[model samples]
Target: MKWTYTIQTEGLTVEQLLRDEWRLSKKQVHELRMAKGILDADETPIRWNEPLAAGTPVVIQLADTVSPHVPEPNPDVSIVFEDDHLLIACKPKGMPTHPNDPGQSGTLLNGVLGYVHAHGGTYAEHVHRLDQGTSGLVLFAKHPVVKNALDRMLEDRQITREYLAEVEGNIQKNGGTITAPIGRDRHHPTRRHISPSGQPAITHYSVTARRKGTTELRLTLDTGRTHQIRVHLASIGHPITGDELYGGAADSAGTYKLHAFRMTFIHPFTGKKLTAQN
Candidate 1:
């Protein structure tokens, strides 16, 4: 199976990719390079000196014969918030929250791994996820109790996530709800699009800013779904800027303009109203 992952550390280079960031020693990085374990997204071989900023998406091939293919590695991340129990970092556009494929690494998960290992930290589980193109505050649970509690909170809608986005065309509504259902785009299993036969998903949005040729909206979710904001906005004829998957073309800035911006939830342990904003 083909799997894709995104880099989540800022100014990360190829050398750092195989060694330092991945917790691989210099010798180990050399070994992977020799074994053809890495490749750029375009399947080109990138030298160990190549530099990829945080949020770059990297694809690793694991099943095919290991010959010679160095996939893409792009790492970019700017933290907006953090705590002992969680990290609400501001993810750049084009970075996946985790790796869904088998037998490989290099993701937000990998970056977290490097961070933890370097500092003698703990493993954190993402209570939620963001699409490769969406940028926002991600809820990461550091400890076990925090993870379980946040998971429960998410299931119960105790967390309020607010995102900022500039979508195609002008949005007329101050606020509205998207109650469409989503499922695997059977035509493209690796991709997701809205389908009537899909599960019910509800998204709420309020117009935050608008101008000619674009509308900026504040998005909040009552339910989480794959491509929730992107699909929902596109379904309403306002695809996120630079998101060609739904409607807009890829942008030169190379980062999705969306920002998680805000989230409100109760502390998993303290029961205090927890809010993080960027």
Candidate 2:
């Protein structure tokens, strides 16, 4: 893959520009230098410490490496958004985000790979993940530069994630916040619970609708803990209606009532506000 950038500030060496303005890590710079990936507008090689005049265009070409996994095509996979820099998809319930164990198939990652492959592309790097039981919008980067930019944005909390869940029982309050600590369940290896010796978590919820023996909620999280939403809701005596593992009713569909409804963030390359939904 290749990307080009126009030099906006003059007198800065390539190393300085990449490190300070582009916010590239030292390791990435080293890789580019070692691979002879930097080039001037005229396709001439450029050194890491080489200084360029203003209006100079720089090109970076990444190394091509073979992939160990090949994803099979699935007609069910839905592509919600795409561009030269990013690809967004809406994953259905029951599909794992990626393969956690060897020989695993039918994951969202596989589906994305197949989609990209169908378009004569070779790579797809996911920026974040959603659990298997949750259905929602997922983002994938087309190149290492785009992936790096997204990772930084997520670390700085520039991406906003929202969800809709159906919980058991009626919530008395119209809306409220749940501030608690979440940690691994002592007894269940695959479960999470509220504990004193856990990471800080905050969940904001508002009642959206109510039905007999069930309530709909709009939830937002301040921290992205492993089962944070499920644990927090269960702690308040309102486990998700179909979350059998979390002490809610069994679901015949083999899925939960949780859905990743919306995501709001700034496009790293275009500087445009993007709002994606299922």
The lDDT of each candidate is: 0.68, 0.83
The TM-score of predicted model 2 comes to: 0.88
| Clashes per candidate (backbone, < 3 Å) | 17, 0
Q: Give the range where candidate 2 is weakest over 10 consecutive residues by summed lDDT.
A: 63-72
Which regions of candidate 2 fall more than 4 Å away from where they truly are?
A: 6-17, 20-22, 46-56
RMSD of 1: 16.8
Q: How many clashing residue pairs are found in candidate 1? A: 17
Query: How well does each candidate superpose onto the true structure, as a TM-score?
Result: 0.68, 0.88
Model 2: lDDT of residue 218: 98
Which is the leading candidate under lDDT? Answer: 2
- Model 2, position 226: C-alpha lDDT score: 89
